[model samples]
Target: MAGRILIVDDVATNRIVLKVKLMAACYEVLQASGGADAIASARIDQPDLILLDQMMPDMDGIAVCKKLKEDPETARIPVIIITADNDNTSKINALRAGADECMSKPLDELCLLARVRSLLRARDMSEELRLRDSTARELGFAETPASFTPSATIAMIAATPVTAMAWKTALGNTLHDKVVVIKKEQALSLTKTQNIPDVFVIACNLAKPDEGLRLMSELRSRPETRYSAVVMVIPKDANNKSATALDLGASDLMIEGFEPQEMALRIKTQIRRKIQADRLRETVRDGLRMAVIDPLTGLYNRRYAMPHLARIADHAKTSGRTYAVMVLDIDRFKAINDTHGHTIGDIVLQEVATRIKDNLRSVDMVARIGGEEFLVVMPDTHLDEARMAAERLCHVIDDRPVILAGDKGNIAVSLSIGVAMGGLHVDVRDVGQLLESADKALYCAKSDGRNQVTFSRTAA
Candidate 1:
């Protein structure tokens, strides 16, 4: 099934009719006879969306929507309220109660199906974000709560300046958000530095018939404006374009003309949703970053470095070039911690990491593999180049003294490096074997004298 939809109506015929339509579209349909039963089914079944009847003997659609929004379990599911009343009041009330859409009775079948597809698509995206967030929380990386709400901006684009200004005035009476009137050309030419609106209200007949659809597509394709919500305003004679508008990524639509209250409500809903999606995306990015980065040193962790080194080895094999791996350890790191305290020891480790990073090329990989040890992989490098780079790292560390905080003085630091070569002339293909060879070389460096470089005889 494409998705699961719950139909809630007091009448059996209403439920059957809606179920048949949804099932024809490859959707699994569930039914409820009243508002109370609908809420129960929603909490238990966790359907992707709900299609609700406005007037029921037990409770109204607006009340049901408010109840659902108040509950955490069913709050995120999208709800569309079907009402027999065609007045603007009903639409505004339903929207204020947190209904995603309000449709009048004698529904247009094509437009209804298009709206269903759009809502289901949005719900699926939200579900995926929630799933990732759940995983992040389980990994002990919870997202920080937002401190404040930012004011939203809306851009109004119409066929003529007069129409644009009229829309601005109508929306201004009800909305406190910043609304700007712009031409089609200006809308498409927005820059990154300029203020980007949170929502766009576009007329379908801008300069020509169905020209706004093309504009919407352009906005969707652009990186800066792709996430902004768009509401297409269709004329009374152009009802056939409603499905096209929704399919082309319109968040909502205003038919015939604008009703100030209804338009304001719809715009607010779009802004709320956009903000939520943006926050979820940011949390997911932060979680992924935290998973592979060392918090103290800000270097790649062991989890990220092992796979990365294997990829470099694979590339070297295909290109028929040589690569080098180096295992580095801070000499007498534990004694430094015991003598200067772990706080100063951390400072020394950070300074050493910085020096090693600055001396290496951008293509080289460096990671914190243990408390006092780091791994570096250099591709397309021979034994001589690797020796020179390792020597350079040793000289750079021993040359300077890391300054301590407060009245304390400076402490000297040095590194012992182990080098191993692989690919082309080398027979080693296993990453574990390469690491073991380098580790043996590192032992040789420690045994001979600290603060020096050693090469592995096994691989080189």
Candidate 2:
């Protein structure tokens, strides 16, 4: 079926242009001039896809996206943010707002149409799967009970650095597509991140019942993850600890020597008894994943950025150690995006995101919160140190021109970065504010002349 679409933009020209393209593709189209009307139409008309504008007079696109996502009725509807701005910060905000896609403005009609079709297809496919599953369950003979069924999904965390295949034996060796392993240490340390595992599989040997128990207790303590499960593997001889482990709030226990098939059976049995339990576990794990992660870049995002910022702030306050934030901007980004188009713009953003990540230390946090805008949370860095890093990033981006589509030549872009450091006035949330201050400095650099770095303050 041709999908219904909503094009939300304040610009009449852009709206008209989009309408023409969507209509040509046989989509039933709706138009909203700004964010408020868009939300109203979204709830009422329930369009299949929405093309949201980043900057609107009434409400910005990011705010609009968050509002829609917050509303249960409108939440599942996908939003694609369209903007002239191609800075990292703006892109970061869009993803954080749960924007399904981002398009830098001077829109490409073909790209827009293609994206619309793709999203609609995906939405339809998901709905079909859900309905089919429901139908199969109703016809009991046609469906295997979730326990013995290979289809039941369980959220798992392979905290032990073990391969996923091993977890299947107990968790359902059915080879679940969703099963994944994230480093336990990485997940644990990223407390500020949004993505947390549904169930944590800690080595009974490595993470003691005490440590695992503490984490499990904390997971259950949080209203968000209270129902989430924790699976622990203890030595077979450690009979005393199993009771203690369960008491501390572990949902399941595996001994050191569970065969693969046996392990899968245990997991399947759990799935049969309480499907919602698996769901609850997934909800928490997924929420944890979202909690501290920056959705787009896969870098440690806003959620995790807080504690690190505060730690730096604290270190700056107590010790003489200082850190700096470089508000980085892509030079002439709008032009690159305008001339080549947003798909290419997306490629550029990913490249720049990669380059910035590669150039940073493990101690640093790199985030894309906006279109073509980036923030580097540099711990123990002074303005000089931060400036040097900015300079390095600028050179790195400028050093190579990325190859883009449609015979588009290699394009090289420069960066304008603003530097700011911590003192008494800085709060953790002020990282955004600090970034803003640095952005102003970066703007100054751009205004003065592109291809250079500028500090937020003229004086120390």
Candidate 3:
């Protein structure tokens, strides 16, 4: 099935007709006879989108939409209210009640299907974010997003400056948001560092007919503006471009030229949805970063290093190049912790990590694998080069003394490193065995002396 859609109508004929249309498009259709039943089905079935009838004997579409928005379980699902009334007031009321779209009866099939596809695509994106947010919450790495939303900026672009300024003035009377008038060229030329708008209100026809749609496609393709909400305004006499607009990634459509109050409502809805999605994306990124990074030293943890090392080894084998792995440990870290307290020991560890990182090339990977222990993987490096690099790392750490946070004294620290070679004419193919070889060399280095570099016996 392409997606699951719930059809809510009081009349049996209306439900059947809508179900036929949706099922023909390969959608799994669920039907409800009234508003109350629709809400119940929405909560239980969790459809991806809902096609709601405006008038029902038990409850109106506005009341039903409000109820669904109030409930957490059904709030995120997109709802489109299909009504017989074609007045601007009806559309505004439905939008204010939280309907994602309001369409008059005798629906244009092309536009209706396109709208369905668009909303389903958006719903899928939100679902993926919700799943990630759930995972982050389960790991205790993310918190619920705060309710406060910052003021948004909306950019209006029209075929002529007069129309654009007119929109700005009209919207200014209703929307407190900053509305800027810009030419189509300026909108297309916006860069990432520039002040990008939260929402873009575009006229369907720019200098040429349907030129604004071309601009919409351009904005959608650009990384900097792709996430911004786009609303395409169609002229009253213009042919139906709603289907094309929705298919090209428009967030909403104003079919009947510009009505200030309705446009304001739609823009606000788009802004709220965009803010939510942006917050979810940020939270997911933070959670992912927290999972693989050592909070204390700001270095990649063992969980991220192991697979990364394997990738480097694979690349080396394919490119017929040799790579080096070094496992290093602080000399007598426990003694430092016991003598100077763990706080000083932590400072020493951070400084040592910084020194090791500074000495290596960008191609080299350094990670805090354990307490006072680190792993470095250098790709396309010879055995001699690896030995020299390890020795350099040892010297840098031993030469420097870590300063305590307060006016406390300094503490001298040193690290022991074990070097192992892999890939392209080396015997070790398995990552586990290669790591074990380095670990064995590390043991030898520790056994021989506290602060020195040792090479594995198998590393030619």
Candidate 4:
């Protein structure tokens, strides 16, 4: 199913009509007769979205939307206010009441589907972030997002400077957002600017032969501007253009010669949606970072290293190729910490991590498994190649002394590395046992000398 949608209307005919349309789109639909039933169904079913009727005898759609927004469990479900009122005031009121969209009676099926798909796309993204955040919180890896303030910037682009400036003036007078008139050439540069607009209002066919379509495609292709809300404006007669714009990744669309109040309401809704999307994107990034990274040195930590090693083992076994695992220890690391008071010790660890990372292949994995210990996994490697790689890593650490903070002089450092080979013929198929063999070799290297490489007997 694309998603679950709840339809709330006092009239049975309205519910049936919407349900049929939504079901044709392969969405699971739930019906409610009035506001009371709608609230109850939303609370219990937790649908992905709500198609709400504005005028209900028991309670109005605005009040129901407010109640849903207030409840933590239902707050995230998007609401689209469906009504007979075509006035700008009604649209603005619905937006202010936390509805994501407003559509009047005698709805156009094409426009209705476009809005539904866009809102559901936004909803799916938010739900994914929420699930990842929940897992991260359970693992004590979640980060608190910045407190949101109701501020946004919108850039308007049209065929002529006059039209662009008119839009700026109209939107600026009613909305609190920073509205600017942007040209076609300046559209791509917005990504480089510090104050990137939260939403872009594009006039379709602004340039010759539908140049606005090209601009929208360009913005969507670029990483920085891809997530910004794009609303395309088309002439009243260009119904086909509006649908194409939506399919081409426009978040919303408005007809040409639009009402100022209606434009303001739609733009405001787009801004709100963009802010929420931004928050979700950031939260998901933070969660993933925390799950795999070491806080001290910003390297992959043991929690991530073990599972990665197992994957390498599986690949080597399947391909009948050889792989190597190396355990490296910083020689006399505790002495350095004791002598330098831990602060300098931290600096040394960070520098060592950088050096090792810079010297490895992109396919290799290096992780900090202990205070002074690291695990490096290399796939598709032979015994000689593994030994040379280990030697190279040793030189990377010993060739240059790490400079310290506070004008402290550079300090010499060295490493002891132990390498163990694994493949279809190796006795160690389990990553734990492979690591154990490497550890045994590492102990030999440390015992023989502090700054050399040692290979496990299995390498013979």
Better of 3 and 4 by TM-score: 3
For candidate 3, which ten residues in a row score worst on lDDT? 130-139
> By lDDT, is 3 or 4 better?
3
Q: Ten consecutive residues with minimal summed lDDT in candidate 4? A: 127-136
Per-residue C-alpha lDDT of model 3 across residues 1-460, encoded as one tens digit per residue: 6777999998999888888988999888999989999999998888889999999999999999999999998998899999999898899999999999998898878888999999988886776566556645655778877888888889999888898888888776677788999988788889989989999999898889899999999999999899999999987744358888999999998864657988889999888888998999998677658697888888778876776677677656654568899999999999999998988888888899888899998557789999989999987677889989999999999987888766888888888988889987554358778888898899999999778998888894
List all candidate RMSDs to the true structure: 15.7, 23.8, 15.0, 13.1
Write the residue-wise lDDT of candidate 1 on 68-134 in tens digits: 9999989988999999998888998998999999988988778889999999878767755664555
Decoy 2 TM-score against native: 0.37
Give the count of colliding residue pairs in each prediction. 0, 47, 0, 0
**Higher-scoring candidate on lDDT, 1 or 2:** 1
lDDT of each: 0.86, 0.66, 0.86, 0.84
Q: Give the Cα error of residue 322 in candidate 1, in Å.
A: 45
Q: List the residue pairs that clash in candidate 3.
A: none
Which digits, one per residue and each the tens of the lDDT, describe model 2 over residues 261-320? 434444443443235444333432344345444566665555445445555665455434
Task: Look at candidate 1 and tell me the lDDT of residue 78.
Answer: 93
Question: What is the model-wide C-alpha lDDT for candidate 1?
Answer: 0.86
Q: Give the C-alpha miss distance for residue 81 in model 2, angstroms.
A: 59
Candidate 4 lDDT tens digits, 58-145 = 9999999999999998898999999899877787788788888888888888878878887887776665455445545555665776
| Per-residue lDDT of 157 in model 4 | 94
